[model samples]
Target: MTEQVMAAIDGSQFSEGVCDYAAWASRALDAPLTFLHVVDNHPQTAEADLSGNIGLGSREHLLEELAHLDEQRAKVAQEQGRLMLKAASERAVEAGVVEPRTRQRNGTLVETLSELEDETRLVVLGKRGETAHQDSGHLGSNLERVVRSLHRPILMVPATFKRPEKVMIAFDGSKTTRRGVEMLAKSPLFDGIPVHVMIVGAETGDNRSQLDWALTTLHEAGHVAEGEIRAGEVEETLRAYKEQHGIDLVVMGAYGHSRIRHLLVGSTTTAVLRKADMPVLLLR
Candidate 1:
């Protein structure tokens, strides 16, 4: 089956770059590009006021007002959604992808995408939403939440990133790492790009076999790849490897352990996303 690339847009300026990147990837992979904008039902603080009244009649009036306000917001959202999708489709055309499809959804962002994950070959989200404060590379909660919830590859495009060159794979021989390896091996996104598969953690006698497996998979895919098994903390090791190699993008698996474990000990994926200066492609 042909791959399907889904880009989650919010009519934000940052989403334009995400659409462009997804479009380029779609063309490169001969995949279909889908531009998606979720009309969030969650209201912003500016649209609602709670300080005016607290009586039952006042509450009923507030509900009525909120309902009206939601209708207006939905209208504006629909207009913007059309424009965003149109612009994204034009961009895909410029990138040589014809007949890109655009979709508008109304519901929880992560929940909706998760429902569509089966047909989606990859999910692309802007690192930060349109309302995010400038100068902050920190991703918004929704993006982060979606990453944690879904079991699909997520390609997060930074607000200002133009394109990527070298790709880095954070390999550790875990199930998640293997999934990422499988994705990179089959996906055209990393085609023709040098894949630096770095295996962090203390190298045991068994690690060599894992390295061999990763290398074999890439080689079978006709990709140029090299493996490195280093001893150190996962975050520090990957960060150092990125610096030394001038890596343009980092690919890894998202959350691995249970939420409780992750909350207490923090997963390597979280650490990498939070600290890595370059773009990250996370496989679930």
Candidate 2:
């Protein structure tokens, strides 16, 4: 089956940006594009039962009213999801993706995407999402959760959309970082784009060796790559390199670990995400 770039649209501020980036990925990879909108289901009952206060007839009437209200809510939510998907699909089309497909699902975002992850090569989403629209400080809860649950490559969009011509891969000698090097070597996702492989923090002979190997691998795969071993903080070094070299995208890896370590607390990946103003293509 042909791989498709699946972009999740929640009508967030980043939804249109997601579509624009997704369209770029679709064209760059020569793949089909899919726009997915997930409608979260509302709860039908509270944690504790409250039926004891009403008689049988009254309970029945109340239940009927609640069910009717839920039905109408379902209708409105579905229509809203449809409209969001339509707008996203149109954006993708305008961005150069011909005949993009749109899907509207009902459930939690993670669950819906988990089932459809097999057919998707790239998953695009906003930084936080609709829930975080009010709070600029808080990241998207669904974005963090979905990233943990899915094993596919996720392209996190910033506030604005721009196609990246130069990409940077942060190599830390970890398995995830090495895997990113090899993955790029075998894939055309970053074809024709200049790659800068940087190793931040301590500068040892081993780190130099790793950078040399990465450059070799990238060169073997027909990519124009340069290696640089920087000594500083991960985010700070990356920011300097990105600004100095005009980096358009940052490709980093997440090691296999629990959700808490990957998305919260003291993770370098989280820090990089917070600092980067450009698109980040996260690899696992």
Candidate 3:
């Protein structure tokens, strides 16, 4: 069976852009695209006790009004979710995708995504949501939380991204890196594009063998890939590599070490995502 690419949609403009990107990628890989929307049904904040100033009957009426408003909001959210998925499915068909699926869940985004990860080959989400923080660049609260929590490949779609051409891969000797390499090797997402597989922080003398191994793996998988080794800070090296190669997209492993180590020392994945200017494809 063909792999499936899942995208989270909530009818926001940024989410719509994410749907478009997901459609493009699914078509490129000849995979199915699944659009997901989560209806937030969490309880609303407690109402202020205005009953002190009002009669008992009036207080009951006020509470009923509040409940009615909450119900209306929930209904609106569900309707919007359905509309977003329908529009995304239409776009996928217009883009020539063979089969597309839509799913709506009522729960936390993280839980819904975790449940779908087993069959999802990739997860695409918007950089910012309806309630994003103002200071963050590539990721806001929802995307950040999902990225940190999930152990799957995620493609964070920016609001202003056009079609991607040249692709850059941040390759290191990690299980996540291996998974990324295997996907790129077998998938058509980067088939006809120029791929630069870069290994940062490698010793100059030992770099040749590692590059050769990466190149051999790609070649054996029928991908025309080139490998290079660079020295310096991981994020800086990747930025310079992108500039030199005019990279349109950057793909890398999400986290390298254990969760405890990441929490203590900070993660290179987070650093790169915050600093990189181009679109990012993160593999976990």
Pairs that clash in candidate 3: none
**Candidate numbers sorted by TM-score from highest down:** 2, 1, 3
Q: Write the per-residue lDDT of candidate 2 for residues 52-74, one digit (tens) a residue.
A: 67898799887787778778887
Indicate the TM-score of model 2: 0.88
The numbered model that scores best in lDDT is 2
Error of 1 at 235 (Å): 1.8
Which is the leading candidate under TM-score? 2
- Model 2 alpha-carbon drift over 4 Å, by segment: 43-63, 133-137, 256-266
Pairs in steric clash, model 1: none
| Runs of candidate 1 exceeding 4 Å displacement | 1-3, 44-48, 51-66, 132-137, 256-260, 263-266
Residue 206 in candidate 3, Cα distance off native in Å: 3.6
lDDT of 1 by residue, 1-284 (tens): 46589988885656866887788778777779899888876734345467366777678877787789878988898898889888888878887898999989888778888888878888888777766655554656777788778877788776555567788888767788887888888877778888888888666877888888999999999989898999987888888888899888998877553345563124777777766565788876
lDDT of candidates 1 onward, in order: 0.78, 0.82, 0.77
Residue 156 lDDT (model 2): 86
TM-score of each model, in listed order: 0.87, 0.88, 0.86
